[model samples]
Target: MLVLFLLGTSSSALAKGQKHTYWHLTSDAGEEAGKEFESQLRSVLVQAEGTHHTTEGSLAELLDQKPLKVPSCFEGAKLCTTVPELLVEALGVDGLVEGRISAAADGYQVELTLYREFGGTPKVVTRSGADLEGVVRDAVGALFTLEAAIKIYTEPAGASVFVNGNLVGESPTRVQVHEGNHGLRLEKEGYEVLREDLTVLPGEVREYNATLVPKVTQITVITWAESAAVYVDGKLSGASGAPIDVMPGAHSLELRANGYRPIEITFDIAAAQRRTIQLAMLKEVEDPWARREQAIRTYRLYVEAGYALTLQSIGFAGATADIAGSTYSPTSFGGEDRASLVFNGVKLAVGYTMERLGLVFLGVDLMVASMDSELILTAQDTARRESAVGQGASHIALYPLQGTFRELWGAFGAEAQTGLGVSFDSLNGDLTGDAFDLSQTAVFWSLAASGRYYLSEEWSLTLGYRMDYDFADQRGLRHGFFAGVGFNLPLLVDAGGESKDESLPEQLEEDVPVEGTDVPESTLQKLEQSGTEGGREP
Candidate 1:
């Protein structure tokens, strides 16, 4: 019976050609019972597929030992003894099976341990029953045949799979695992890890389909302005300080806010990386009209001192004169005289300007003129008088309407102004050894056209031609050419007030936009090109 049983077991083992060894089975029941249990386990293992079984007696014979005394410490539930480094090589088997049998209250307790040649944690199974053979058979079957198949399929295949922290095959692949609890982990480049705990029963086939998520590059944009809108890859993402998720690649980022310059940049991101971008928006320059309006409304003081050459025509009325020994009545003596005089004057003005509206100037002008020439009193009288005359005038000057037509070069501009005021004029001199004293108060008006060359922000050279008419007893019409230096001092005032400086024409030329003004088309195209290139809304 023993020979026939060995032949029956060895027939399948020889055909399979895989080598597994029954190391030993020990028991406190007795040596005879231990031998019988070991023989039964060896016969059962040899009959099973996948591995040929080698008995401990045959393995000991190969080692030239009468009997093998495997250590008792190696037979316990815990691995209390160190395994030999060359134990598998010395045993000359693909795997080893070892067990311990102890007396239980029912009958016997069996513990089986399976160790493979490719070293790993050994699998152990424990069972107790009154039937010793049944208990041994069941424990061996649990250790050898109780396996589950897990078929792992990943969305993007080729992820490395780990079972119980040990690297298994890549998905989508099949792994044979011992029937129990298992920790499954899948890892792929640019994809999130998938981890799961699974419990499988004996001979169970589990289909585990895992959809691996791609790892995102976390992009955090922190902007100086909270109202700034953020964009990634030309898509509006969110506002400042919001986090964006993107694939690991090169991307374009942009930030835009009203009244601030827009920012754009490109950067590359890595997988599973966190990147932070900090930005500060630059404020755009105010509109030209806005700056012009602000500057126009600021209060200013103007002071100008100038020299004027004037040709004055004086009408003489109600004058008493003797003609050829005949006394002429005062009412009948009416004539005109002309004089060329040089005048030095100073003018002080305060004013303000409004856009689209005009400007106002309230000023005081003081002038003194001196003349040394022979003046004929009249053509009818035929009298030539060598006269030394001094004249002085003080005028309250007001200019209510002013307009600037254009700017000539960058530094030069022109304006036309008209004004009316009240003047006090005095003349006191010796006329051919006679006292000639006259005082006249009159209402005067003047029209002026001036050209300015700006020297600085507050200073300019002014040349102007003015015509003045006086309504008084001695009606005079004067044509004057004046040259002067003008100074403008801006008073720091809020925008609510209306104020203007004498330099407003220059300001308008540089800052303010006028209607019907011709701007170069290329300049406008450049401005539009820059705005479009920024990729931001106005």
Candidate 2:
């Protein structure tokens, strides 16, 4: 008959108890007596909440099938001294209890050995009494439970601790534990859960300490862009303004904005480590029209000096010497004379650009240009005298006024300038037989266009074309091309007294170490100093 007993304990509490299982090996006692002793031991184990198994097969059958080789006895008689490990393996149990009955001064003697399945010697228990059944039952009941004491603590002092999936009191406390292997866990809000496996020894007190790491890691991402989206690995995290958590490892970071080229950076961080990163996104170059509009918004101050070659010709009306008193006609100048009109000159300009007004810049430019030209003239029919109307011409001087509009596209640029000003001209040559000087000052206007390529951030090479027309008509037109370099100076202040780029926040502040953290003090200080320095610099 199957018997059941009720021990008034909660099922969960019973289930939480340490589990023990053992096999009862056939004893060397008389078969009837050994069977009776095993039955009594089995009843005791069940009362202790342990599960037990007994083999019904013959000993010869069990020994033949077990994989372990049997040690030979000297006479080849089947070795009666049982190897407990072999019996335990044959029955597939955690441990085995084997007993032998023998003659003694008392009515009988029962010798029992508990062999745990793992490595080590067996535990021997002996009982000498009038009845063997009572002694075996008493010996088997005491071996079911092994007890030890364990004290656990954490750095932060209040972490909830657990053993074998059952919560104990908060850490920094000691608890009685069942021996063998068990799982230990410590947990708290805002900290990583720490789980470990521990082996306990019976009648021993063990001490354990754990340092909990933060569950969230703080990482500050900084960029020179406003409202730019940030990406960690491949997923979009947030915009440019806040600090966020990122997994500690190598990751591809990207910054994206409407008019700026997306910036990509690769970075790494350690576990529980804090850091700051700075990103600089470049402006995307668009069509020339858009570039021109952008350049007008912010331009710099510069001084440019270059060499120019002008092709110019002068025309004059001379009095005819027929029978009339001063009849004038236009003089016809030939190719050689036109060749002599070509002049080499130098140009220097200094200018300041004001704040942009819409798409145009309002500013003034003072420019100086000089050229020397030879002119040839003759009087008709009569011998000309110095006191009479002059006969030949010589040199001329000119001055011009201009305004400028400039645009930059990455490393390349273009400019167009037009304005009106005044010019002073002096002409000198020989009249008939002597030297002569003739001079005039006239109003003039000029137009110029230039293409520039920057060789560096502040220096550029330029090619230009210019035309100056004299309003008096006689001076004709002076037009030519030039090549030169230009440079810019950074000012201490702008139209708003400060550059907009300077107002952007630099490196973000480093994450501060939490109180009671296990991070080294020197490391935290180093991170703080590095963040301060980065924020101060570009």
Where is the poorest 10-residue window by lDDT in model 2? 357-366
TM-score of each: 0.39, 0.35
- Model 1 stretches astray by more than 4 angstroms: 1-215, 221-250, 254-263, 270-272, 277-311, 316-337, 354-358, 375-415, 429-432, 439-444, 451-463, 469-477, 481-538
Candidate 2 lDDT, 105-185, residue by residue in tens: 765567767777664788887777776555655565456553567889898789999988889899899877776788999
| lDDT of all predictions | 0.58, 0.55
Clashing pairs in 2: 394-428, 395-428
Candidate 1 lDDT for residue 280: 42
Against the true structure, candidate 2 has what lDDT?
Answer: 0.55
Off by over 4 Å in 2: 1-299, 316-340, 354-401, 492-538
lDDT of 1 by residue, 164-250 (tens): 999988999988877789999999988898899999765556899988888877888764455588888999887876778887889
In model 1, the Cα lDDT at residue 263 comes to: 77
